[model samples]
Target: MQHLSRRQFAKAAFWLPTLALAGPAWAQTGDDPVEFVESQYNNIYIYKRGTQVSMTFGHNKRLYTESVMDTTDTKALPVEYTKFMTAAVAYTKKQDSILQIGLGGGRTSWYLHVHLPDAAIDVAEIDPVVIDLAKKYFAVKEEKNFAPVAMDGRLFLLRNPAKRYDLICIDAYRGPFVPFHLLTKEFYVKVAEHLTEGGIVAQNVEPSTMVFNAAVATMKSVFRQVDFFPAAGNVVLVAYNDAERLSDAELLKRAEALQAKYAFRYPLTDLVKGRREPSNPVKGQILTDDFAPVETLHAIERKNEKWK
Candidate 1:
């Protein structure tokens, strides 16, 4: 196994203990926060604020929130598009089953389980620590209909040939970068393979990234139709397996139906209103497993060239 030098190792070990004194650290006085961190991926920070319990992944000088739950009620989704993700139920012809990638705090999966009790909700998570946090702190129950498996999202899809889903939600982010492998056309082809006829995929995308267009293009290569729904700063891409486009008028009708039946805390109509096609569908190069430049593109996006 590769080993970190004492100096390098200490950097990862440092400041974690100091934060506990900072407040609501996910550990007791004798416990260590370093235990929650995964190798070379993220330094996990778990904390609680009043009725909210949250998890953050710190990497590349940015602390991205992994998940947050309302301690008072797990059914109430704290994130905006998690409610929007339910919009998939509107677009898809069936709501029999779902495959959600990236368990995080397990709020999305939990919400799906509660709202669509009849649907089989399967969640594939890459990190055991994330799963533990969800169950222990976030109140995600494991029942017959709700299955939480510890596996990479892509591998989970590849391995489960017999299993198919009406909707597949992909929002797997690793540290500062969305996993390059997950953003590729080839991976989405696998995602398309796991879908039932008339199935749709709901993916949480970082529109701020320079590679956003490329990411959409990659998805479009596999799925016949792709639509974008604005969510705060991010966008959720709903890709349909069949070659058909849905107009805003059409989506609004569907959204209204879901909102009336479910009465989501955040009305599903906003997601419908936020709908639009890719501004530059062919702008960025299509990402592929063998030739993805996600990190490079992100770095370019971060670099402010306005001054130059």
Candidate 2:
């Protein structure tokens, strides 16, 4: 494991995702039309392009995508980062239960519910409109097995009495920036409490911003092992409860079995191979509840990326 100092990590690393390779027009897999809009802290919208539907924040860019034709969460899997989230399966023998912090289009939660109907799945989405849109347009069914809790991600972790899950995923996005509360070291500590033995917590991180390195560092502070999968404009961090890291061969062995059983479109074999170790961030530089300059970092990253 390469343990670079905080300063070294910041110097060597870039931030997280914009899915630059993924625009409705770029993918050409959709006939995008504005379906619903709610303007607030984040300009949330549900866009429809042919049978393809997506969740967009702030702009027309598809942050979370889905397809009405194939509601299995496969057709809607437009971004590689979303595919990378599923790599958490490599850490477990069975997907007993899952807790997702964000419910963008409800694709991740929906996929688990569909694939593992017998398993319990809970989703924490702060936006009620996003939840409504998930059902109305995105075809995310309201199933008894899948619970959609309208609450903040951090609060859900702190308050929820059910303190264990086989897998946990965090993908909260506020406009183009991440919620500071959700990116803190304290937040990850709460996440760690909920993880069962051999459990995995996978997060979608955008590396095109300054928060990327700090975010990974915060996660590293709590979890014994952290691994990553590089996706288009993003990186998926998979932190494990176990101290020992799984080799690529072992992860692939589990990936192959799960793939055979589920016949997943995004192969776990491919995702498991992109595993990267985490590096430490500088002291006091990592995000915390009291001080997380997420908006500021995002602004800097946007300018640095030359994104208007």
Candidate 3:
């Protein structure tokens, strides 16, 4: 057996439990079929088990599931975090235009596209391979209103100065960690610049990471109201420039209205109930492009954990 370093061990420990929790029913069977496997920006693996298809990226034992979809029922969002991400709709009454930083299996985008047929959806996926896989296996299709561009999210935002969105979702992840550039305060400023009035940004953040507090702090520095929806092993952050924070009653009312209109597979009302108070006096420093040490923070967090 190859000797694993402490970091490797910690990463394995972190992912193993999540795999057990988030993985499809076939995960325990050990008979899942590999639909595709390739190496590019990351080692990518696609698995198909029954009606479920999943995309995972990583090297060796450090694998992380990026996206999962139920092929038989596209609206049935299998991942808990994706369901939480849909809660972003409650924050904005008009989703005329939406910008999603990462495509993943295109589950979230597809769900939104189905429910908000009038909305124009733009997806930025840095990896063309993932986009191709999403179309080939995940039932993702590009139509007149839906556009998936092959480009880095930050570059896409930088290049399109005039484009604004009613909602912006930052679910980009390289394995379990967000890209360093995407986590910085500067990157968030660019994200905020692209939002239309009353627009909101929803991000999927892994709270287990040491940079979690810093990520929240960075968003607080840029946006006036930051709300949290904690899901299994992840937290979905809803941040906007509103002067007054929406009360639970208000959010619940919006959620009820959305639910009545769309009747989403995952109830928006249940997701809204997951919302909790933000951490007061967030502990970490605001992450700037010049000083965001995300990898270092992850290492420190792992080092502090008591490994059995």
Candidate 4:
């Protein structure tokens, strides 16, 4: 028996299917589609083609397409920073139930699982292939407390109501865009209805795109306080339905408290508040299941590539 690296197998498998479609394209078995395997705190799959490279990470027992860098909860707070600690402590200390929409690289969720040993995690993912790859390469199945469901995220939330979550994380997207159904104000309302009082919903969104504004507006329409914070090139949307004030001062205080306990690189003191884009000049439209022009944002992202 020969030991084959996960990348080797994935390249062979992906190329084989692709060649079959193109009527016998390149079939060199040794051709490496994967650029490299990055294993630090988390396992990263870097696949290459011509000039374009795609990065993937395993989370919640699933393989998710990722941006080139580790953008985890950076939008909310740095993974090595105390912002996450403050967010977790602020929202989830009292509840044991957490629901996650997308499992990407398992970075944020993995931290949550490790920190909250007693919490019940429910994950919703639609792609079975991603799940299979994650189990084999990403150590997703090792998360014993996680329960994964193969279904549309919005549909799952609408159908299931057995247990209410204290913290809801929405990070699901289709390629470079989030599903339209998941971006509507009604969707936020449903997420709110499913939460325990004072519960907060945190979402990781790309700020270079209009989807960020749409998501924020939707969250504001439903939640009492909709705030956005920058982490690298992404933004984390934090929405609290209660009248609690997450002012800069309050957030900083919590970040300091968490730093004393976690000791992360670049304390929360380094985080700069992100200003909401001027939606006043540009009329914003509601993203609906019927008419979400998410693909349009891809064009915008391409033009703004220099900004990233």
Candidate number achieving the greatest lDDT relative to the actual structure: 3
Clashing residue pairs in candidate 1 (N, C-alpha, C atoms within 3 angstroms): none
> Against the hidden true structure, what lDDT does model 1 obtain?
0.72
lDDT string, candidate 1, 66-121, tens digits: 67676777787666666666666678777789999998888777887887788899
- The residue-level lDDT of candidate 1 at 240 comes to 93
Worst 10 residues of 1 by lDDT: 1-10
lDDT of each: 0.72, 0.68, 0.80, 0.56
Clashes of each: 0, 16, 0, 1
Tens digit per residue, CA lDDT, model 2, 8-103: 221122111112334455356453446656644455545443334555564434333322223333444555566678888777756878898988
Arrange candidates by lDDT, highest first: which order? 3, 1, 2, 4
TM-score of each: 0.82, 0.79, 0.87, 0.65
Between 1 and 2, whose lDDT is larger?
1
Question: Ranking by TM-score, best first?
Answer: 3, 1, 2, 4
RMSD of 3: 5.2
1 or 3, greater by TM-score: 3
True-structure Cα RMSD, model 2: 8.3
What is the C-alpha lDDT profile of model 3 across 1-308, one tens digit per residue?
12122223223433454466568754466634376556466667776655667777765565577777767687877777788899999889687999999998898988999988889999999999989889988899989778999888999999999999999998898776788999999999999999998999999887766688888889999999888886666778999997999998999999999899888778889888888764444467799989998988876552221111
Report the C-alpha lDDT of model 4 over 91-207, residue by residue, as the tens digit: 333547888786644445655665566778788766554454445433456567777776777888888966688888887765445777888877887898888867778887666
